[model samples]
Target: MIITNITSQKDPERVNIFIDNEFAFGLFYSTKEELGLKKGLEIDEETIDKIKVRDELQSAKSKAYHYLSFRQRTQKELEDYLFKKEFSEDTIENVIQSLSQAGYIEDLDFARIYVRDKTTFKKFGPYRIKNELLQKGVSKELIDLALEEEYHEEIQELVDLVKTKYSSIIQDKSEKRFRRIGGYLQRKGHSFETIRKVLDSIDGKDD
Candidate 1:
């Protein structure tokens, strides 16, 4: 096809390119320059294919940056978002590598920040935080390391949280109460063993 025209977009950073007098695509000015695209230039099918790939990569990366502008996201979250937006695998992978190398996407850093927020602010327990990070595409090793470094602090926080729940007014150690407290801890992502241990100290009741 023959290039018919190239026009500046309102954003100034992008341009609309028409081939054979028909609008084909919009590309960043940088892409336009790199591709040496200009009016009246002749492009074969193979060259058009290359341009499509470049456009896809640029579009996908731009979307990724826009998504991350709000806050950080996990690799899996980014991938899923791009996939839903209909970006191809090659484009998604390219964006991922670019963002990761740029330090915009770091699993370990994300895990640490996420864990701290959930624990300190939201009061989420180990099980819940670990599960969340896993779902967010953090490796098990990194999760273990992040939690292990603050093992004592986390356990102490868990104990304090349980105390806050079990005030002195509720003295009855009934099966129902045990179940209720256990369920609460479990829902918080605390293990049964830890729940039982805490219950033993606080309620001194049989379950």
Candidate 2:
């Protein structure tokens, strides 16, 4: 087929190529120039396939980079994003592999950082952080490792949280008040054991 026309897309970096007077494909302007695609250039089906594959991979990588620019993403998050954009499985896999190799898709590191930030800033307990990491497609093992490394001071965190946020309930000094405090901490992802320890410490102070 002979290249019949080339038109610039609304995106200045992209262009549409027409072959035999029919819209053939859209490609990056740089790619078009690199391949020397222009009117009157003869192309074959094999060449078209090669161009499409190369362009698809490049487009997928570009989109992934843009998506990741805002924040770190889990592998599953990136995969879903690319899939939603209608990239083929092969293209998505290729992008994922490249990102992984470049250290942009480290689930373990992501989990560690997430756990640290949530625990330190959000006051989230291990259980809640674990659930969030699981939702983000982190493995249970990695979650456990991150929790172990970053969540070592859960008891102290719980103590501070209760003292700061539930002081009024503690002053009640009733069984009902303890239950209420326990419920609140549980919702914040603390375990029953940790909740009991905090309550015991408060009870001891009263004695």
Candidate 3:
């Protein structure tokens, strides 16, 4: 096959070579190497082709792993991320499918764990947690399932947040303390009802 064109990849170390307008090979080199020609290039055609295939597969896998390392991402999120990084559609699809089948890119499970950690550990509320899961590309059905089972835990979390924030209110003697505490919890995604109940119980102690 004739190398018709060579294009520099976004990665400075790599290049894409086309044969008769078809993608035929990819190249990796350092900046010190000569342009338009390869150095230390002693590989046979058969070896070069095999190396290209292996590199492509390895590159896709590396991208998938690096994407997952920061935090859990849904399959769709990872796909979109890889696409933005200029991976081939087929490669991105295959990588995402493989990761999902391997149980590494599960949207439902990710949503559950994410919700649990943020609500129970981080003290975030349901609305905030739900919105965060949506941002992570989790489906509404999965979000609903996680939320249904986590309501009591999240409520208890809200109670804990109230307790932690109560000291801030103790400094103010007037209604200012109650309003400030309410707004604070509201921003944290707690509803008016829960905040009111918590505040009422606190107020009863003051009476």
The most accurate candidate by TM-score is 2
Stretches > 4 Å off in candidate 1: 9-12, 151-169, 200-207
Model 2 Cα lDDT, one tens digit per residue, 40-128: 99999999999998899889998999999999999999999999999999999999999999999999999999998987888778999
TM-score-wise, the better of 1 and 3 is 1
Each candidate: what lDDT? 0.82, 0.89, 0.71
RMSD per prediction, one decimal?
3.2, 2.2, 7.3
TM-score of each: 0.84, 0.90, 0.67
Error of 1 at 117 (Å): 1.2
Q: For model 2, what is the C-alpha lDDT against the true structure?
A: 0.89
Predict model 1's lDDT versus the native: 0.82
TM-score, prediction 3: 0.67
- Runs of candidate 3 with Cα error greater than 4 angstroms are 1-55, 153-160, 166-168, 171-175, 205-207
Candidate 2 error regions (>4 Å) = 154-156, 205-207
Q: Write the per-residue lDDT of candidate 3 for residues 1-207, one digit (tens) a residue.
A: 455666788987677766656776676643213333443234357755656555665677787898799988887788888888888787787788888888888887787788778776776667878887888788889998987876454444565666776776654658787788878777767788777776666656322
Sorted on lDDT, highest at the top, how do the candidates line up? 2, 1, 3
